[model samples]
Target chain A: MELLDFARGPALQFALAVFVLGFLWRIVSLFLMPRTKDRSAARPGTRPALFAATREIIRRTAPDKAFGKHSLFALVNGYVFHVGLFIVIIGFAPHIVFFRDLLGVAWPSLPNNVIYAAGVITIASMMVALVRRFLNPVQRLISTLDDYFSWLVTFLPVLTGLLANSHLWVRYETLLAIHILSVELFLIWLPFGKLMHLALVFVTRSQIGTHLAHRGAQI
Target chain B: MTREINVQAAANRFLAQISGNLGAYMEACLHCGHCADACHFYAVTDDPRYTPAYKLFPMARTYKRSKPPLSWFGGAPKVTEKDLQEWEELLFDSCTMCGRCTMVCPMGIDIASIVAASRQAFVAAGLGPPDLLQAAENARDKGSPLGVSADVLADRVEWLADDNEVDIPLDKEKADVLLTVSSIELMKYPDSLVAMAKLLNHAGIDWTLSSKGYEATNFGFLSGRSDIAKIMIQRIVDAAESVGAKTVVIPECGHAYGVLRWAGANILGKPLPFEVVHITEFLADLKRRGKLKLKPMGDAVTYHDPCQISRRGGATQAARDLLDGFATDFREMTPTGNHNWCCGGGGGVQAMSRAAGLRHKVFKLKMDQVEQTGADTMLSACANCRLTMDESKEHWHWDKDLGSLVEVLAEHIDESNAAA
Candidate 1:
């Protein structure tokens, strides 16, 4: 009970603070950083640049025609874990209760069983992705220590949350505290590693989408 | 003893090029391995070194070093002279800046642009393919990268006009459109320029090739020398302004049009006075205005999109629209439009002796794509692509003929509709 209180109170607060500030700092730096300007007159596209850029946040969820079967597998498998993680984070009742505690706002949540299923799928998909990363030459070549660490931090929360929900591997209170702590670890590490892609994927993607628009094309 | 580049200056050059959300792109890459699939270099070689994102490592390191927490942690250990030396091939030979990876990235990171930045750093370190570097010098010193001087251009223009019996105007002042010819067409594929003459004549567009700045291909762009690229492009801009031309038509060269349309004003740090259009785009505009009458080309033809012209330049439909105007059987590559594969010889690969093996190997991937189309002739707008494919087509004993899109249209052009 004491561990749970510490995890929920101080650790969670500290992690959230770091996460928010770090994310903003990085994002702000990116926008504020000296970027090359296209001073040339642009050939207008089908729509405005900003609109095309914004559309890419949703547009990049699927692969284009150039991506082959193996690439398709990697992309589709990525979505499985991403969608699962989204459900577990946003739809799970306990996670929403946590959010409500933080923000003083609440939303309807999914059934516990559904959350459990999502957690399981997320963990499984993440494991497969990790395995692919280890085996795939390109991924292995480019991956850094941060990638593995980010994966660990992200995986621990899902694994611990599932264990807590199932009451299988550890005492319920201990597992619950560990899950929250793992989530806090993920939050703290998020902005420092490639996990920052959660925010930056949209930033860089929109830059291209809008860039293509300026040159008279769509994403 | 080996000469060492000033690492500090190269690093600064790398830092300067972190433009257009490059900081975010460096941050956002998931290293998912999908980018490798999109690269012809990696696809052909199966070498991890050819991975598109892998090539951006030095630039990414420089970017991270400039930022906060990563900066504090060893400052990502500044990119070394040796690293630049090593990256010369990766930045130049192995990659074409084709932008297929840019189209395919889930993060939509413009990996090609980042690679180009890396090339700039390579250039700052005096490390790049010798032919490209020499050509950049030749372009500045001589009139053309291929050494087609003003005298040479005049001689070629006169010879082609007399031989073909076509009115190839040169250095005419006060023309409406200032036509810039690629050195490739001036030297190797003169037929494309003749074809352009025929098409432009048919459309009745007031245009003249400039003796002052006739060469369109900018080797500086391939060598990553912005100074030289600006100089090369400035020559054309000066010619246009001198003539009081309303528009400039870039010949059938990919990066030539790309430099003019996209990067010209940005490189010059001012807006161009007139419009810049690719020869194909010029044709498409003529067709749209019902200026040029055409007959159907009774052959199974397919179009290859030059990387800089279509994928990066966004004049994708221009060539296709022109093809549809004449080609009775126009079969597109499986993944056509902005998603086309590169000819494997772009970005100065065709000029490098060391990269010939890899360049030839990568050409197979393009050959396979072309083979699948099964068109009797494969047509492309850029002379560089046409030449590269023509060489490879001979190597593979490809039955399909390689042709310039402009030449094909000229062959089928209805001379009755030509301007008086």
Candidate 2:
């Protein structure tokens, strides 16, 4: 019944190993790939400037104006999914409660109602994204089986969490365990899938910023 | 006088040709909107409708829902019914396919390719920009964008040659470099041809322009039909092989550079045995080796990044190093390098008469940046950018010398006939 028991369990340990190893493998592969030769001898530095470049990147990538007509749906829904998902990951009561008991310190947890709302929004946004992909021929052609699977993996945890909250069909503890397991699976998949953009986003943004800055770009 | 358009057949063929590579990229768009600001049309006009993402929407919707029960729901929009003509016009005429949006896309969606494919579909439906369509069809039939006669080319070649020295070969057999030029250079900008010839002559570079494949413009690029593009490039490749050219210098048009540099390997069945360099790259190589020297303009100078040269073509910096020779106060626009704004004349927009107002409006982004720098002169590597910037200066009355990098560099060539 103790929170530390779940943290120290075999499932968590196994998933952590897979996640760490998988994450390293992907990053190394990207690093090792053949880069386009610099035909012009304007040296883009050897040591990657991750922080400085990312700041410039975020500034450029910032939307100057709202996205075009009827585009608010995609933009607003995407933000909700991303922000709400972030809250549930870091602010879930169970996660904080367990951290408090095991690590002797914890961050604040969202109210149970807030967590439920986050879970609902995550599901809603994901469904919209999936529908957009499915109904759009251009999107569908570019989509792969892995993309659909990522959506499933992404949405399932939120769905299961909401189901656990409802406590309608299954026992609360059983559904709660499934939700944790799904979260664990998703975390392990993060660094491998398109989700890795979460970490590489800054890398690309910074690279663009620094390269432009070197070229004397004021923007 | 008139032929009926086969809208459905054209659409199907275009879809089939692009479905594999383009479909792969289209599926990746999470619609993050990162690329919206990067687009020249969107940046200048602040028109959400002009965003690269919106241009691909009709195609994306149809692509996603074309199967089974989804097809029953009418998932994709087609160019067959009423208002389909309007959608075709929007997709084909509105977008320039500059590829700046592709560089900024988080998913690396290659938005230019998507726009190009959509344009190809539009062209299939006979819905391409009237001017662009005329040019493509003309190039398809006449072998040059201006519909220039062989006699005019001969006269221009003769004008570029010095009477006392070596004759510029008309159809020389087996040269080291096959120099191809943009249609503009052939017709309007004789100065570029003269500059290229002078550079070639000064360096003692063994090169010949193909009378057969003299053209550098490929309309398949504008029409979005890869097959047409392939056929157009095949002419250049065949001509290069005929002369056993070890290198090909595609003169400074962004799309021309892109076609020669990127499409060469694909259309030629391998990496071009002959090296393919943009004229800018050729000049940069000469500059780096100290073979070419320039008298610095010693004035405030700014450079505009052409989309094909910078992003698709990757020859922007090479052009800049050459420009550094003359610029006293060299300022760059906010988002330069691969992330720079487009000239808006790309993707046949310059020739697309209907898109002229839009092109001029979109070009203001670069124009404003140049003006803010207080630069009296601007240098661009791509011929299209040079043409567009010149038009911008004329239309907007922005007092600046919009010169091609080659023309500028030729003025600074330190070596003389006696010295060499």
Candidate 3:
């Protein structure tokens, strides 16, 4: 089969199946695990714990004031990469067309130039993050194979997508096929690797906030 | 030869202890190492193994093995007896279970709570430190981790009553407050008891110390054994209930307040019959209501926020408010309040002799923070923190006077209020 045909048909189907079924199974089994009951009394006369949880979902994404200066590099690059990726994935015109075609939902898209700029910035930030992970001793010590693998899988799609969109160094159809394949690989790896943070960031942050707030902490 | 550790049993125990929050924290950690700067152990020692996220490695590995999708592949690292041994040092000795790391984590993972669960797993594997185990045993059987007997408490109370010409009420029925203290205070600083008695007498509040439950430190909570913590705290609950007291006053011991304030309800499986208040909060409330008056002291004093009382127990504002009321030159530690660094000796680390060298090493961070303020007096509400600071002072050969807020207040009690 041609690379384009393989990427468009069987590979796409397989990636979607793994992504959907893997996520469903992971989340279900996680939620099904026996959780110890938090019998501690809630803080007296404050907003509900869920409100605190929601607030923290927004609050913790930014650097905490206490450690903000020390963590500025990570925070800035992390936010840039994440926001840039969001725009590239959801707001770009071509991606919106794909989404609308696949799922019958649509939103207004950013200009092509703006999408290109965001993609470039995202790629640059990912490069900085990868270099820091390899160079910084502390980060290096804590990093696992899963961490490096996830970074590579996540970084490739954006790179290949940008190359494909620019139609550089390859035929448009061939580059698009490679980009799609890279994205499929990322999707297949998402539920099983550190990339699971996409779903777990909310779960973990909110849980921390709810518990702390119930104890009357101001987090 | 190393004693055989049941790796399967340890993994099961860890999995069983997994709360929804813990599971989410394990899965969500980005391994960014941002929490390293917040941890005193890692910051002072620059040891990567002491990094908060690194400390959670074994438990996270075990969690992944239990998790699906990944579990199907079975590629997650296996938990071994050797891994548990190394983790015992990482979780119990090096890390103090301080929540500073939790405060700074962008992912908002409560790494400290996860460390506590890891300690529980260590205990389940029969690998908890002997010192902590003995302390828990003492609290379980002897009623006090320090082995302070009921007679010793009675004797101390009698001595304080005679020395201060104040009525020291013990086991009084139907008091308004049941005052409890740590054995550390009783043994190392009985003057804090004197201060408490004099203040309570000055306020004209009905309070008594119970011989049965006056010991406030809960080693079970520190050791991560809920059953033992429940037993230790229930003695106080029964004492307060028996006296029909409206409130239980936890003294300047941070962990005491932590156990009674945060974990009290959960241990009893219901709301505590009475209100639990830290002395700082209680005193601050009285001052806010104009019920207690204090004479201002003019010396520059910095207050060390205890991890349990301020960060974990929500008493930061009260301690600051009380300090504002009493000290004319109150200096703030950089990163004070809930973000304060620990004194390197909490979460039962103070009791573990094996952790002494590491504890002292981590304490350099707190020492430098305190020194930066250039304050002559360092005051904290937690007795354990005060004890740790005192040791730090001696180790570093610093001349700062380590003081307790309760005793400081006692020294400057408004003479007019005393007459009232």
Candidate 4:
């Protein structure tokens, strides 16, 4: 568990604490921010309406099933990248060791080869999304430097991790340290980036649910 | 039925007709597809060509490539002769100018405005629209969008009085509320008129329907004819002013609500002397004040978000407020409020028969929403949306009742004399 040792150097500790505090602040803002009053009248007693509204929110926000409606390669490849990357993030053996020691909990880690493969796929998919954003006029119009930079920020960890894990570039210790640090940085940025929708989903869903309950509709 | 004008000349005329509006607002588009799915026609048809983006591209490219920095790139996505021909149908026939597209657009491009401009472009090019739009244009020029002349307007109001045994105050000078309605309410949606009358009576509100500025629904909003939109709205503002009505109330038509609430003041060159309240907003106010009472239906009721009244009219919460209090079970359509999908009507597409099939297809979003809800009845606040839902119900055989919020509330209005 020596590698499970804390990168407790003041630099890493400071970065980690700032990341944790900043992430919580973003989540809090989403919860406390007031949206314009929904045009619907508020009726607190309508249980059925609230349930229906809740159910509708869940149904609508559920992931799109008609991947064909989106570009097939984009949708399938994007999902593979996201899902795979998520697995590698938590399922890599070293990550599990760190989590178990630090958080006092751990899930079974994926085999080393699988984690490396997922990282590669994730990097490829990130490139595709970036290229598409640049090439498409509509996407080009809407995108800003911040958006492109965010993608690179996200893709960097996975690309670095794969190189580090496979020993293709640098020593394993150096690459692992960089990967862990970059990940901490990403964690800090998530709530601030467009990724903050994760916090918003709950609020929106609950609002719609409470609203429908007032209308006496079940979800 | 009106005779169709020559398509080529109509397209050219359409361009001339919208030159004024084009000069002002045509440069506002940034081509975000947020407006694309917001359009009922696009939703129903599932046609990318009908998207506000694609529909406006030919014209935008034409102006861009020929006019400025964009012309250096050969006008980014150069428009072809075929694109021009294809766009006539996309702009004129497919769009309803509902302003639903405009409401959802983040940049607020006013795609409906652009569609209106494109329709004018088509008209100028000798690509006249179908019989219904042409008739509406002719009617607008003559007096009403429905071709209801001054004499017919008077007769219709009188017929309403005789038919319902309620006297509609005509041209009353300085009433507290100048209640206005679109032409459809006069021509076919008598039930809406009856509901307004009953509500006004129940609330004991001082209101009068204007005989002079009778038609509140402006076809100019549809055809992208600013002169017509201005003239049509001015007539209502003038009538309301002449009558000294403190507030102007718009009924359940989406475009009419947008005209008065969103664009009315601008058209008049000042804030309207009176506040323009949509019927839903008015009804919500009455309920809030305990002026109107609803007997709970205690049945499964789903709500449809009319593009104009909910999103455009700034009263998305009002309709829900009314429906929530009255229905035993009220379900919301997916993507409700400003994010709600169109009912495949709006703009002037409801009148153009050639676009009906495409319009119906664009309504698939609503149809899918309705299906998901599994509610037996759906309520809407716009006549066109209600009508479009009814048509979708029949076409899809959804076995659901489509109705206006007022109509539903009006039905449940406990007219018990014993309580009084």
- Residue range A66-182, candidate 2, lDDT tens digits: 233434465566667889888877788877886787579998788888888888878888898889778744355445444676778888788887898889678877777787788
Candidates' interface RMSDs, in order? Answer: 1.5, 8.5, 1.8, 12.1
lDDT of 1 by residue, A1-219 (tens): 499999989998999999999888877877887777787778854578678888877787767778856677778888999999999999988879878987899999999888988998898899999998899888898887777988999999999988888998878988898999999999998888889988788788788888888887654
* Residue pairs that clash (backbone atoms under 3 angstroms), model 1: none
Chain A TM-score for each candidate, in the given order? 0.94, 0.79, 0.95, 0.77
Q: For residue A110, give model 1's deviation from the true position in Å.
A: 1.5
Best by lDDT: 3
Q: What is the C-alpha DockQ of each candidate?
A: 0.70, 0.08, 0.68, 0.03
Tens-digit lDDT track for model 2 on B16-94?
A: 6443335445444555554666677766766656667767766665565543222443545564544446566556666
The total of clashing pairs for model 2 equals 18
Local distance difference test values of all predictions, in order: 0.84, 0.67, 0.85, 0.65
Best model per DockQ: 1
Candidates arranged by lDDT, highest first: 3, 1, 2, 4
DockQ value of candidate 4 = 0.03
Q: What is the Cα-based TM-score of model 3? A: 0.96
* Model 3 Cα lDDT, one tens digit per residue, B43-160: 8787878889999998899998887677787857888899998888888888777788887787788888888788878788878788898999887877788888788889888988
Candidate 1 chain B least-lDDT 10 residues: B69-78
Residue B366, model 1: lDDT of 72
Model 4, A59: alpha-carbon shift in Å? 21
Here the TM-score of candidate 3's chain B is: 0.97
- lDDT by residue (B125-215, candidate 1, tens digit) is 7677878889889998998888999999889989999999899889897799999988888889998889989889888888898887787
With a 3 Å backbone cut-off (N, CA, C), the pairs that clash in candidate 3 are none
Error of 1 at B224 (Å): 1.3
